[model samples]
Target: MNLSEHYNALFKKSSELILSGNYTIDSKINDESDRRFGITLLVRPNEEIKANIQAFLKELKKTEPHQYYYPNSDIHITIMSLISCYQGFSLDKFSMSEYVDIIEKSLVDVNEIQIDFQGVTLSPSAIMLQGFPTDNSLNVLRDKLRENFKSSSLPQSIDSRYIITAAHSTIMRFQKKLENPEKLIEVIEKFRNHNFGKFTAEKIELVFNDWYQREKNTVNMCDLYLR
Candidate 1:
């Protein structure tokens, strides 16, 4: 199915769980010993879209302030997870120049992409801004990244979890047990069709980061521009 269809399906399933008070709660949120790191290539949403989502977050906070919401700085649409987070990783082990060269070649003539963030959706763990690339540019770019990374001898475990095709940007993750999920669900339903804004990405950033992508735990690595 297409991105829109997939987003709708996910919304339907997740919202049903919310209505039935069956949404998942993250217990590890308070665990300080949790240590995992990853390398991801992602696109930051435009300021207008970020402002729009932050406004929506204000509404959600009134209903459920206990849940963790991603700060505006961390809001992004992941293009690819080059290396999913692992238990032990040495950042110095990988050559920065090699990855840069490979990715630069991969984006040789890729088309520019426009992601329209049109609504709010959710999974048991998180609330997301529904994103849809206006054309096949996103698919083409992802395919190129997978193909190029596979050909390179440098270490990369791209798509080991699953082949990513969605453009959705996760905005919030459950940090605690819901006090009244029905109330939160009502807030979610209120913005079910809200228009966040559009993000026509010009560049994608590759970063070494902790699982949460916290600014303090992240190091900027490379900038890849779209055509």
Candidate 2:
């Protein structure tokens, strides 16, 4: 099959699985989440800084084959993962649209946002950029979404203290076993100082991923307007 046909088939199969209620898998206790979508104010860096940071990530991916690292998407700090679907429950089209509005109303005043990826580290499942300045801004929006919407209506698990509630991006996933833990962190420490300049926090997006399909992971990006 051609590339387009191949992806189309995969997307078809994935949607079928979801509609059939067979793909609603829960994250394991130890699985660290790297995927997030929301109103993120991405700090745009200068060309030199952006190039330098990207080069660092490229080297990390090469040296650390054991960690699951995906290619870098647009760099931005996350506000929240608009809970898309959960096990045992299906999100209807209208409900999804309404809740998007609800989520928007919840975070009307959050105009300014600050973020930085200080360095990298190896989690048991993947390598992540250690981020900073965990303020109430992200959490407040999360709590309000839960309060305004029923538990089953949101896209992801909304339990208090849930790791997704903490915003951090997984830069790489170790595909193979690491021979030495010390070596992994040692490499991480080298680029630990890499930083992307700050951007104003303005909008949120309903980000979804088609994890079942290769190359089509970014399923949809729905923009959430702020007042």
Candidate 3:
């Protein structure tokens, strides 16, 4: 199918899944000592963009009051997962310093990526703001980082579905089964074509995950700036 057809199909399938309550939460299997780290494009939206998205989120909360929203501080677009201590790993073998060095070297010649938040889309577990880069700069950076990881001793993501093939910022997640799924779907459809805002992604961060918490938020370990 063509691009439009492909997205339409994906949206429809995702919508159905959201309404059916058949999606899984973003999580991994790990012991108490394990930590998860993701290599991602840290999107620090400007004040204007932040205000616009916050307003939209406030509106969403009016209808879906029970849903879980991501904090403004945690917004980012993942490029790929680097390591998971769950599957036999230690900081000594794959240090955060090493990850930063790899990302910095790989992105030495890369430039900042301009991304436009054009619309909202639904996936099984989260509501995402779909992003389109103004150019292929983000893709080029991702490719370069992937190449760096290929030659490193860092272990691949334990979760097979955690690959970053698309650029999206997850805005909200379902905390419980919605009592009125159709109504929620209607509200989301209204914003399917809404323009959220735009921002430049300047750095890739090595983020550490605290999975023991209820929200499972990530902590910024280090940043690699693009030239």
Task: Tell me the tens digit of each residue's lDDT in model 3 across 137-192.
Answer: 76787777778878777665523555455667777777666667777778778888
Residue 173 C-alpha lDDT in model 2: 46
Every model's TM-score: 0.95, 0.61, 0.80
Q: What are the Cα lDDT values of the candidates?
A: 0.85, 0.46, 0.66
Q: Which candidate is the best by TM-score?
A: 1
Of models 2 and 3, which has the larger lDDT? 3
Ranking by TM-score: 1, 3, 2
In terms of lDDT, model 3 sits at 0.66
> lDDT per residue, candidate 2, 1-227, as tens digits?
13234333443454344334443222432234534322212222234434555776777656555444444354334454344333323223234566666766777755544444455443345444545543556556666766665544544444433435334455554454455545545566576555644333445555553331113434443665443
Candidate 3 accuracy as TM-score: 0.80
- The lDDT ranking, best first, is 1, 3, 2
Ten-residue stretch with the least lDDT total in model 1: 26-35
Q: Which wins on lDDT, candidate 1 or candidate 3? A: 1
